[model samples]
Every structure is written in C-alpha cells, then in structure tokens.
Target chain A: MTRTSTLSPVPPADAAAEPTRVAVSTVIFTLRRLPGSETASVALPLVRRTRDPHEGLWALPGGWLDATEGLDAAASRTLAETTGLAPSYLEQLYAFGAVDRSPSRVVSIVYWALIRPDEIADASDENVQWFDAASLPGLAFDHNQIVDYALWRLRNKVGYSRIAHGLLADEFTLAELREVYEAILGRRLDPANFRRQVENSGTLIPTDRFRTGSHRPARLYRYNQDVELADRGPLDRRQ
Target chain B: MTRTSTLSPVPPADAAAEPTRVAVSTVIFTLRRLPGSETASVALPLVRRTRDPHEGLWALPGGWLDATEGLDAAASRTLAETTGLAPSYLEQLYAFGAVDRSPSRVVSIVYWALIRPDEIADASDENVQWFDAASLPGLAFDHNQIVDYALWRLRNKVGYSRIAHGLLADEFTLAELREVYEAILGRRLDPANFRRQVENSGTLIPTDRFRTGSHRPARLYRYNQDVELADRGPLDRRQ
Candidate 1:
C-alpha cells in the first residue's frame, strides 16, 4: 500500500513550530580483496564531507532527503549526488534521531545498499573510494554506528540468506562464492563443506559457464532468478 | 570502542543551521495468552497521546528524542513514559523519516522491544491497554509500518532462534511455549515436530519443576543462560 500525506508549508500561528527535518544518507558497502590477497574483505564507500556538520571528515556519501520523494528514493538520489554511484540493492537501515546527532536538529534515516564490486568498478569516479571495514577513519555524525549495525547485519545475514551473492559478480565459481562468505564472516570455512551447503540450499541454479586460467577449470553458477530465497521454507530457516 | 562525537553544535545563525528532525516511534510486541484461551495471540501496549501532533490519538506511546540521550535510550525512555514498561529485549528497527510523517519537524528512530505479557500487566494504567495485534485501530504517525516490520521480523525470527522464550515467564511448559510460536507465526504447528525442533536446538534447558495443571503436568523449560546463541556461529547461522 502507498502512503501519501499533504502537509501545509506553514504551521498555525498559535502553535509553536518544530524544526524542519529532511535528510537522506546511505552506507553503501561491497566486499573486496585486499592488495595481494585472494581472501575477500568488507569495504565501505567513503566521501569527504565538503560542507559543515563535520566538514572535511570522512563519512558515508549522503545528503539531504528531498521534500517530494520517498525515503528510499531519496537515499539513492543522495548517493548519486555525493558519489555518482547507483546501488543495485538498497534497503532501509536504522534511523538516527538523537536531538544532537547533527549540529543542527537534523535526523537522518540511513539506508544500507549493497553493490557488487564489479558494479562499483564499472561506475567508478574520482572522489569515492572503498576502505577496508576494519581500518575506517573517524566518521561524521552517528555514521560509525550505522556502519557497525550494517556490518553486523551483513555478517549475520550471509549465513542463512543468499545475501552474500549481492557482493559478487553475476556468474562466479564456487571458490569465489566461498571467499565472499569467508570475507564477511572473518573466518575460514571448509571449502568443500561450504560448497555442499550452498548447493543443497537450492538458492543457486547451475550455469553452463566455467572459469578458466586457474589450476583447473571451475564451474560457474548464477543466482536463480525465479527462486526468491527469502520465501522458501526449510532452506530459509534462520541461520 | 566508544565513539565520541567531537563536532561542536552549530549556532542557529550559522549557514549550517539545518532543520530539526522529526521523531519516529514504534510499539514492539509479543503474544500474551489469557487464562481461558487454548491459543495465544499478539498484544501491544498503547497510550493515548495527551498532547498535540496527533494529540489524543491512540498511538504507540513515544516522543521526540532528547539532545543528550542516545537513540536506544530515547526509545527506552519513550516506552517507559507511555506504559511504565521497560523491555528486556530491545533493538533498533527500521527508521521512518518521511518528510510528512510528523506534523512537526521530527524524525523518529523507531525501536522494537519484546517483553513478557505478564511483566507488563502491572504497568498497564488508565492510558495503557494491551490490544490484540489483529484488532489494532488506525495509529498515529507511521506506527502501522513500524508494527508491520516488527511482526514480520518476529514471525521470521522465531523459526530458528530461541527468541520466543523471551516472551515467556522464567519457566514455562512446552505447550505454552509452542503457543507463543504458533501465535506469532499465525500457523498451527504439529506438536510433535515442534517439540522435536525445540529439543534439538539445545537453547532451552529442561527444568525439574513440572507445570501442574488441570489435565497433565507439562515439562517446564527455561532459556539456557549459559550459552550465547548469537556467538555460536555467524549471525544468520547462529539462529
């Protein structure tokens, strides 16, 4: 159902006016391998805030929520404005509404979006860079909190859900997929067991493509388009 | 690590004087079965707003976040103010910050809290009453969205996690516990299978005390305090 509201631009004279609230921000993340390493790692997009409210500080790329748009739409718009990136997968994260969270009385509803590393690379721009999740610099506002929560959710969700696939290319080998899980989880998984579990889950459909130039040719697979993993039972059981 | 914000509050005259944000609220829930029922049902504690901005509207009791308190504390305080109740289980839910969600400029960070029905019964006052989830009326602000998300999470989460036990008393029978699950999920579960799954989860510890009642004495169980389910595996896998 769509929710719409028509609000007057001005408040009644007798009523005390509250501060205007409108800002949309995002914490976009992707899994990337560190230099000289085959093991994957979590990375977040960072932009140096050019204006006040923690100007010059490293923060997630975001800006004001538009007055005439949905919060989700505003998030994508803000990310595009700040980093020139459009995320393929976006979902609402927690809202930060502490009265003093912003220098002004600004409350930010932060959305977390996942972009495949390849997607980010294709749309790469000069100002934006992905930093290792562990070595992030001090962030502006309550952004660090947002990042923490997103990381926590990502790590936890990857176990039972096929969300980790969102971080990989469309067609990937079993070894590459396992690396994605291992990276976010910060632990090494038994490669054979991990592949077995993933295949048994029925979320992945086998593709004819195979990866070459490795020690051996590895089979490639794509996510099942018709299979909405979240709706499936037994397979969708909480991790 | 404690993250301390060092950005000084911008003066009102500064160009960075952003509009103050709005408050988002949520009513977290769990089912409480009254004595006469064979099945349990969902319930939420609500308060009548005594002031404007939807004054006198029956809403999920909440208010704007204070300047000094964190979002979590603000949510806890708001819940306490309305129902005189404090939930043992509380977490950040999605934030609702539609520009027109509030009559005033207030962005809310809605939170979902879970509590045993009996624990909150004592706090029920003139303004507070536990209403069946299905029978809720039009709520103030965007509370309907908050409740919907919470219920969705509850139903989805109870499958693998022992979170349902948080809604029960210190010790409860398998039937009563199963009722909690069935009520939230809105499905009738086979008693034999439910028992088997719960037993296999190993999160519940059997108690020596049997629940003495009209028919047969049912076995009592309690949440196993010793084990940390969240730490057992990845967040999703732990469940």
Candidate 2:
C-alpha cells in the first residue's frame, strides 16, 4: 500500500533529539464455553512478557511498528506472529501515549479484533494463553485499562452493528446469536425481545436450514453482507 | 505528567537505527456565518506549512508530540500553538501511521475539536486561517483525507452526543441548537422532530429564561453537565 511520500522533508538537525517511538498492539476477543456449564463467556488471548517492564506479566499480543508498513499492516503482522490467527474483524481501537506508559517514550496504537470460534483452533502459540475477559490478572503497562476500553467498545458496538457475526459461523441459530450478545454484555436478555429486535434489524437473512438436536429445531440465519459489518460513517480501509 | 519509566531498560545498542516519530494533529471545527448569509456552514482553522514537503500548503493545526507530555496534553498544546484558541470539546479522532504517508516514518495521533463562537475570538494567529470545510484546497500530506474523516465523525457524533453543546453558547433556544446540527449535517432537520429528540435525550435542562424576538418568545435551555459530553464508554480523561 505504499504510495508516493507526501510530507515535507525535514532536516536531520531539525528533528528532535529523541523521537517518540510507535508500537502496535491488539486485543483479540472470542467466546469460550465455560467448563461444566452451557453458557459461554468472552475470552481473549494474552502474551506473557518475556523481557523487562512488567516482565512475566500478561500483556496484549503486539510489537513495535515496522518502518516499511502501515499501522494496520503492522497490527496484522504482529497479531499473526503472536497468535497465528487472522482476525475476522479488525479495527483501530485507540492510541495510548501517556509519558509514563513505558520506560522510553512509546506511543501504542491499539487495535481490537474478533475471531470466529472455529478460527480460534488455528491459533497455537506457546507463550499465549486465553483468559476470561471479565477475570483478567494485573497486566503489563496500562493494558488492563486498554482491555477495559476494548470490552466497553465491543459491548457498545454489538448493540448497533452486525459485528456479532464476527464471532459466529457462516450461519447460526437465533439462540446462538443471542448467546454471543449475552456473553459480551453479561446480561440475560429476554429471548423473545432479542429475537424481535434482531429480526427487525434487517441485517439478518433467515436461511432455509435449521439446526437439529435441539428440543425445537431453530431456524438458521446468515448475515446480509450487503449491509456493512458496522456503520463506519464515511470511513473505508484507506487509512 | 512524567513518572519514573517502568519498562525493562533497553540497551542503547538494541534500539532501532531510526525510531518511528510520533506527531499530534487536530481538526478544529466551528460554525461561521458568511457575510449576508442566513445559514451557517462548518469551518475549521488550518496552519500553513513552512518547511520543505508541501511547503505553503494548508494543513490541520498540529505539532510534534512532546516527550514529556501525555497524548491529550500534546494535542491541547499543539492546538493552542497553531490556532491561539483552546477548544471547548476535544477528543481523539484517529491515528494515521502509513509509512509512505510522510517523508519519514511518522505516526500521527489526530484529534478533532469543537470551539464555540465566543472562543473563536481568541484565535488570531499569523499562519492560521479559517476555511469552509465543504470546499478546501488540496492540503498538505494526507490531511485532505484526515479532514474528511474528522468531518464524518463530527456529523456522526452530533447525532448521538451532547458535543453539539461545544459549538453553542451557555444559554440558547431550541432553534439555536438545531442550527448547529443543521450547519454540521448540511440539511434542515425538522424542528419538531429535533426538539422531541433532544428533549427526550435528557441531556438538556430547560430554563425559565426566554428570548423575546420578532415572533414568539422561545424558552432558553442549558446542557446538563452531569451527562457526559459524549458516551466515551468506561474510558476517562487519563489518556
């Protein structure tokens, strides 16, 4: 995605003595069924820091920004390196740049992503471990706060966007879809109200297929690709 | 805001030869009524580039990230330096870090701000000038695209948040508030619908004060400070 460089040239002497460094990080979320329970919970992968500043502590999977790629590219590369899985949905979360965030002056451009449950099987890394989003340990740096913000955004976005599709298979039962929202929001939604709201949203298309093995066969539905995953307003993938 | 650096100490030898530099930029939007015009339009201040790349081209008000300051502080400082005015509302917009977007590997944490009409009086800088957002000249770097994103966010946020209060005076009639939305959205919103929507939002506090004019006296209102400027969702000003 390299194009002609457009910024004005700066003299080496004019540049500051210590340039602030940029890093890329991601909070990848998926759902995990609790052991011995039918309910699923929101879960995310955290990498144990191998070196200093909070060494031995869990942190979001990330790395320093590469000089040759865009921010999004860097995020994808770091995510793959750490977790070995491509995200079904990825978006820029926020840029954290408090002076005390790191030893050296480092600004982290954090991204939040969602991976389908089936796709999580592809992620196999030694240092990476999954933890329930609701019960995370003290993490490295300000990652605890970062994760909190990401979770808030995920829950808020689910209310309006079709991003729940990112965590589901190509087709799913209405109950399955409601479970995804329930896991993120941590609330028991009235099943009938949930069904009515989702059906009216127009982003779901009922399929002819139905899932068996349940007391009553529930109809399967697919997302309308025509409608966007979410309303990004006028934004595209350009940046 | 600086504290003792906590990250594992990096050997100077391990540092990258060229670290990615972080820059802070802001898009300050306000409403301006042109001479003899009845309706207002969205306008923003821009700084002219004085250095080599895209020199003499207009760009958003901004500067480099100071190593000692937090991201928000950097944004506030740079914005004041560029435009000589403090914003009534400022929020992180987006981070642009395309390696080829600049001559150097620069990552910009961009913010969008809103200034009330009274505050615009303080913004009289030499290189700073206001331009109609709808029709801007080719800007420096990827700023043309950045401005487009900020405008999109501004229009989108106005629909949901009390950020419109940032563009209004302390006390105003319902008609005045609607004008801010109309100017930003570039359309005439139905007065009745707009009134009901805003009143139902519970973010406005009706006052006994009224403005008597050529027609009927309209009651004035103030924003409820208890309600947040916007729903940032579990995030605070810590950044």
Candidate 3:
C-alpha cells in the first residue's frame, strides 16, 4: 500500500510538534499446562520495555506503525518482531487512546490473537516471558486493562466463533477441544453437552483417526475450514 | 483529561513532517419513517465536508481528536459538535488506519452510536442531514467501508444486546421494539417469536401504561434499567 504523506498542500506549522504517534500492540494467548495442574491455562507473552517512560516494565509486544502497512499488517509485523511469534487467529481488539494513557499522545490499535501451543517455541527472546493472564504483574501504561479487555473478547468470541480452533492442532479429540474451552473459561464443561453442541454446530469434521489415550482411544476431529474462525462480517477483507 | 505534549523526552525533530494525526468520527443511527413505509428504517446523520480531500461530499460527522479528552469523550463531543445529537448508546466501533485512507495518515477511532427518534430534534445543522443507511451514496475517505463495518456490527450486536433499546423511548410496545430489529436486520420477523424472545430475555418490563392505537391497545413495556444496553463485559467502565 502506498502511504499518504501530508494532509494539506501547505502543511500545518505545528504538525510535527503535536504528532499523535500510532502504535500497534497484540495480546497473544496460548494455553500452557500449569505446573502441577491437570489442565492448561490461558497465557500470553509480554516484552520488557528497554527505554524510559516505563523502562524495565512489562508491556504488550508492539511497535510503532509503519507508514506503508495496513493496520493488520502492522500488527502482524510487530507481533513477529517483538516475540518472534505468529498468531493463528488475529482480530483487532480496541483502539485505546486515553489522553493520559502515555507520556506522549499515543493511540494503540490493540489486536488480540490466538497462538497454538506448538508455536510457542519462538518465544526465546530474553525480554519476552509467558505469564498466566490471570495473575499478571503491574504492567507498563494501561496494559493490565488492555489484557483484561482482550481476555474478555477471547472468552466472548469463543462462545459464538470457532476461535478455539486457533489454539488447537489440526486434528484433536473431543476431550482436547473441551480442554481448550475449559482453560480459557476456567470452568469444567460437561463432555456430553460439549460433544453434542459441537457436533450439532456442523463446524467439526469427525475423522476416522483416533487418539490412543491411557484410558481409551477417542475419535479425532478436524475443524471445518469452511467456517471462519471469527465472524468479521463486512470487514472480512484482508485490508 | 490533560494532554501529553509528546511521547519522547527529546521530541523527534521531524515529528510534524511525518505525523500520525488522530481523528474521531461516529456513525450515529436513528430510526426514521420512510416516505411511505409503514415501519421506520435505520438512518444516520452525515456531514458535508467543506474542505479538500473529498470536499463537498457527505461524510460521517467527525473532527480532529483533541489532545485533552478520552476516546469516548472525544466521540461524544464530536457527535454533538457536528450533528448536535447525543447517543443513548455509544460504543467503540473500530479504528480505520489504512495507509492510503486519506491524503494524510489519519487513525480514526470510529464509534457507532444509537439515538432515539425523539432526540433527533437537535439535528438542525444545515450541513448535516439524515440519510438512509442502507442506500448511502459515495462518502468521503474510506467512510463507505467504515459504515459497512458499523452496519454489520449493529446487525450483529442487535442479536445479542439490548442496543435496540437506544432507538426507542422509555415506554414502547412490543411491536415498536420489533420494528427496530426488523429495520436494522432488513427483514421481517414473526411478532410472536420476537415477543417471546424479548420477554424471556428479561430485558424489558411490562408497565401498566398502554398505547391506544387505531387497532388495539397494545401494552407498553419499558426497558429494564437494571440491564445494560450492551454487554461491554470487563471494559464497561467509561474510559
């Protein structure tokens, strides 16, 4: 995409002095098996700030928006650059622009993304570390609130969208699928109900393959790619 | 509400030359009776741009984001300043920051709002006029695409939220409530099913008042104040 440089033929004299910097941030959630817990819990990666303002504090992985890239592209670039992680399911969360949110006027176009557990290997950055989304420390700026909102969106979208598929493998047992939901929702769901509900939704394709577990072999199912992970509606275009 | 001057302690010398100006805009929806239609249709106020970069074209009511106000406050201020309407239901829509969206880079923190028909009397601005949202002409910037996204959000949220209540007065009949949905969804709905659904949802309360229409006296129902108009979840606080 080509970038537009200036607003007017004769630019405002004070534009440079009061430029509103645009930043792109992401809340990347993945399920990590808790230390001694039987089930996994939702976790996200945060990067420690290196500069002043909130230096040494943890914040969402992000960077300044490049002039030539679209918002989605900018988000993907930032996510990849900071944590070396790519998201499976990415959606714009919110535009946080409180006057006092930053030391300078900064508008963050926050995107929430879902990363599969297997893709978490790239989080080898020294400044990057995974933390339980539920028990996060005091983060830089309004990041704590931003994560809370992203978590809310994740839980809310999981109910109606096939977003849980983003956190799972290509094929998984019903038990595995339920585990993802349980981890994010922090609740135990009835297996029978979940199975019936997913089956009735027609978004899952039951496969002949089975996962051999300690107790029994369970049927594996793959998500129907025809169904979108999230309903973006009219704004589904890549732009 | 104090504004931060700049982001860095030592301001970038070329900040104005490569500035990311922030703009605030709103898509305020209200029900308007069509010329001959029996039911009201979804309508929104549009402003005629008098400046370059799509001059003389109709656009969403908006203004440059002030450095001193919160996003929600900026949206409310712009909505009132340009269109002279205050939204009963106001929610962040999306941030549109495509590189080539304008002659200059503008990150618009767009908001979609709902105003009751009774509140539209404040819309006396000559440059601001109401238009059928379903058949809007070409708009300024990427506003056409922005409106499409907002319309989608409106239709999608109408299914799960009490946003329709924003288009109605405190006391309204079941038929009145159903009309708002039908207008927004652009389809007919079974009155019986809608009544049962809204009744079971427990978002409305039956009042002793009744609207004595030409046919029959339909009982007037008032929206349950205890229930929120929309489920913002964890971000319900007015940031």
lDDT of 1 by residue, B131-202 (tens): 888778887776766676677776775543356446777788888887777888788999999999989987
Q: Which ten residues in a row have the lowest lDDT in candidate 3 chain B?
A: B1-10
Candidate 1 lDDT tens digits, A120-185: 644344446678987788888777776877888777665423554567677888888887777777
What lDDT does candidate 1 reach at residue A147? Answer: 83
Stronger candidate by lDDT (1 vs 3): 3
**Superposed Cα deviation of residue A6, candidate 2 (Å):** 17
Stretches > 4 Å off in candidate 1:
A1-23, A52-54, A97-106, A121-126, A159-161, A227-239, B1-20, B34-36, B49-57, B100-106, B122-126, B159-165, B227-239
> Which parts of model 3 are misplaced by more than 4 Å?
A1-16, B1-16, B159-161
How good is the docking of model 1, as DockQ? 0.20
On residues A126-183, what C-alpha lDDT tens digit does candidate 3 reach at each position? 7888899989999999999999988888887664236447888889888888988898
Per-residue lDDT tens digits for candidate 3, residues B107-212, read: 8889987888788775445678889998999998998999999998888766423654678877888888888898989999999999889889887889998899
**CAPRI-style class, candidate 2:** acceptable
Residue B26 error, candidate 1, Å: 3.1
Residue B86's C-alpha lDDT in candidate 3? 77
Considering the two chains of model 1, state its CAPRI-style docking category.
Answer: incorrect
Full-model lDDT for every candidate = 0.66, 0.79, 0.79
In model 2, the runs with Cα more than 4 Å from the true position are A1-17, A122-124, A236-238, B1-15
Clashes of each: 14, 3, 3
